[model samples]
Target: MKRPSVSDSLKRLMAPHSIAVVGASRDPAKIGHAFIRNPLENGYKGRLYPVNPGGGEICGIPCAPSIADIKGKIDLTVLVVPAERSIPALRQCAEKGVEAVIGITSGFAEAGRAGAGFQRELGEILAAAPFRMIGPNSEGIVVPKSKLQLTFSPMFNAMVDGPVRIMSQSGGMSGMIASRLAKRGVGIGALFSTGNEDDINTADLMEYFADDPGTGVVLAYLEEIRDARRFVKAARRYRNGRAVVVMKGGRSPAGGRAAMSHTGAIAGDDRVVDGVFRELDVVRIRDSHAAVDATAALSMMKWMRGRRVGIVGIAGGFGVEMTDLVETSGLLAPPFSDKVQKKLRPIMPFYGAVGNPIDMTGTIINQPDMFRDVLNIAIDSGEVDAIVILLTFVGEPKIIEAVIHANEASDLPVLVCWTGGGEDTSPACQMLYGKGIPTFDSPAAILTGLEALKAQAGL
Candidate 1:
């Protein structure tokens, strides 16, 4: 019989009828505990069974000894036992007719020859059982709609319920990026970590998210392309007129060696991989944060009507730096027209530079209203499709407020480069974050983030 596709498997994985935790533990530090606690704490709307031979009730919930002892059907099982014990647990899950299994235990093929043999044997056993598997060394999956977090990352936040899905190979990177996106109130429909590539791959997740109604954008972090041709086909199909940003790691020989040591997967030609991404209209990124920023921007804003960008900075030096970066990035900082200059001239103080990269200068450093006035003129004048406001750390208490108000007022996407340190870093970062504005510490990070947004908008 023909096997079902990954899209079909993900359906059962994301919204299972009954879920069982095979290695449930009482300790909160264990991955098994996270797998069990996250779902129940988040108010998972499905039946949860904890399987442990020595288990009594955990968190006031009854624990079953094994899958065979469970009364009803089991749709999903998370195996968190030692590497050697995973296959037995999987066999038990298969016997109970469980549709899918997510193995979070590590030390599989990534370990060595014996481990690779163990992983292959496990795969062969699963093949006959007609069950879909996520990983022998994966961090597991997260589905926010069900309020389920199967990974052991505490940084995961359940914020804005947007139409974006993230598929990453690094668990730590995924958690960090997800946390950053959550701070911006950008919701993710699903997040999956494809560690070791033992069974499930990124291509499967891309195809799954393509059909998912809740997913409008996809952010991918890949070290290798297991099936490059098939991945491109799925990526093109899922574009949805939106963007798919991919960050391919393992570029240099050193990086490839490190990646191989981590996941035991071959690192392919990075240049050729990038070419394929360009051919398929996939926006390639350099870092995980770039992927997150691009996904957030593209998921919120539409394509730019024009590539002409306007720079509004608090100082001339910052504006010059921004211009250099933007121009070098294949984007243009077209000169503002005479009419735009005339309109903006009266609002600014006498010291401001009023050219393409308009410099608001030090006059507005302490004034909150100046932030709003300059952005309003540029957006209202139709001279620019996007605006970048460079702000140093010397602004007033409500400096972020001014930027937030300007962002809300303009239809065009706004980028904020907040540089400096003050009494409260959390509150200051939170204010801009609350409004969905991208804030960066360095000018280079700001330009890179904006460039990603530009690519997503096809500017």
Candidate 2:
């Protein structure tokens, strides 16, 4: 029989037909209990087998005494047992021919010298075993589309389906990114928390997501890179086709020390990492919120054709501010050409400016179509490659509809920076999000999103 390739194993690991939970517990307080309960609650379609020495039933499902007792082929297995017990449990999985495994138990590698020895033993077992493993200290995986909540995270309850995929070394950071994106009305297709990377490292998953058609953007949170060569190769494969936004930790000496203790990962020099990322054409963002903003934009917007942005706003002051932001963000805000300016003159009020920013003044409050007209003109013009609309306290449905219509009718990316108006403007924002248009609450976030889109487009 042909041995399954690592990619094949990863496919099974991501969307398993049958899963076994080793150390499945009846106690609700334990992570073992959450592992089984989460899948059951989330409507996982796969067959589930919970293994426990003293088990009869867990979460209303029959429990086997061990993986050996499970009668059928298991595609994936999750181990939540103690570190000392993980070795024997893994040996049982190897004997049972499990295709993939996730060791959720901590204590090995990250727990100092004694634990390192244990990790070495586990590696030896995997070397001879047919199945590949994710981690001995990992939080496991979550595939929202498959209803595969393999981890014990409570965030799964709120996760929606979208094109963004998150892969992080820190489980907490992974959940944090997912939650923040969710709050912004952006959803993730899958989340992979590669805890200790005992076997399946970041580069492996990067290559996997590179081929995942459903994923449009990959949001990664990294503490360190274990294999630079493999990482660069995988990144290059994906960079041209999909947007790869990375938020790297451990830039400082103090942060580096913390990262070492947290994941047993050695932090690389920041300058070298930055250079490698730049060479790979990867988008490296330092702030978590900004990273999510970038991911959301990349997931929603089309690739920008160029760095020239057409800024349109209801207020003149914000138009000036956004012009400054656009120029500072390495984006161009050139004045509209004579023909483009002629097209905009009639739509603008006499008091309004009809230059690059195109401040339509307060006239748009009564004439909502003005917003859409300006967008269409900007998009149709050969001058700009993207459009950014600034709305302050204007939440009319017609105005929101205009933005959506303009976005759908053009290949150019349209972004909105909506401030003030509180609840009145929220529905407009939600409507834009529903139509797959990128919207931001602040000017800074909008620029970050635009920068990400430009970078991904290689503009």
Candidate 3:
């Protein structure tokens, strides 16, 4: 058999109508047990069969002795058995005509020479078989839209369906990014943790997500690009429609060694990788925090018209700081034109600075309408491509409402930096988030979001 394409394999793997847990366990501490329990708890509307030699029930579902015993077709099979037993179990799945397999069993390539040899045997089976495999050392996959939680990671409990789709080499990194986004009131449509990349790699997943209508943005965490040509092609195709934000690991020599031990990855030249990302217009982030922030911004705001930004705030000092930060972040903070400043003057206090960073001063605290007026004027003035509003301890519903209304009124991207309110700001922040406006606590974080917007805009 010629085997299936990456897209075809991923379709079955991601949205399988029937799945079998090859090593389903009765013990809760085992990965097999968690895999079954997770999908059931997460509401996987599929035919789930647990394959265990013990021939018992797992979480109320009857277990088959093996894939051969399963009467019906298996769309996907997850192997959680030990390395020694993985090959035989995979062969059973192949015999059963399973469409895809997730090799959740670790101790493959990352486990040293013995593991490498074992992985090669698995690959040899897959090369001649009709089915496709994900990993011999993979964390599994998640499709929130279908409520498919194939991984044993407990992080899927917090998973929600949204526009951002994540593809990471490390399973832990995928969970971390997803958790961080969820905390920021953002959700992901799908997650692919390509551990070891023995069979399916990041490039394959990238091509799949590129055409997925539900995915508005793609976030990736990589240690190395095994096939740079295929990766560049997929990234180019993906970037044509949605933003691709990546965080590359193993940039340093020491980090490269760590990556090698972690996933058997060989870190290539960082300078060459940086050049490729720049040319492809990929938003490459360094830390997990920035990855989450960038993903949220790109997924929510979509894109900015330009790098020019209108900074509006209630506090003057924070306004000054944001002004400096915005410019330093490679974005423009142009002074408001005379005509625009005229519209802003009546709404501002005498002590307020009404230039680029329009400081409403503390007086706006007493008059919330002034805050609304400033945002409207900034949004309508057309002086800047986007707006970043700074607020502190001002949790008034009207303020949040004004932002929501302005965001809806204009095509320009609007971001909020709400800080110092403690628990009081939760409702207001939640409101902004609900409206799809990116909200942050610190000025620096807000700028990080804008930088993502800038990258997506190709500015």
Highest-scoring model, TM-score: 3
Cα RMSD of predicted structure 2: 4.6
Output the worst ten-in-a-row residue range by lDDT, candidate 1. Answer: 255-264
Give one digit per residue, the lDDT tens place, for model 3 in 1-459. Answer: 788777888888888999999899999998899999999899999999999999889999999998999999899999999999988988887777888888888887788887887878877897877788887677889988788988898886677888888888889989988876766667788888888787788888888777777777888898877676888998888655578898998854343443435234543467667777888988889998788767877867446877899998888788888999988878999999999988888768888888989988777657888889888989999789988888876878888899889888898878778776311237887787677665676788788889988877677
lDDT of 3 at 407: 83
Winner on lDDT (1 vs 2): 2
lDDT of each candidate versus the true structure: 0.75, 0.82, 0.82
lDDT of 3 at 439: 66
Instruction: Give the residue spans of candidate 1 off by over 4 A.
Output: 1-5, 157-160, 238-240, 251-268, 365-370, 393-411, 420-432, 457-459
**lDDT tens digits by residue: candidate 1, 286-339:** 877567667766665545666777888877788888899988988889988888
Ranking by TM-score: 3, 2, 1
TM-score of 2: 0.91
Query: Which residue pairs show collisions in model 1?
Result: 160-187
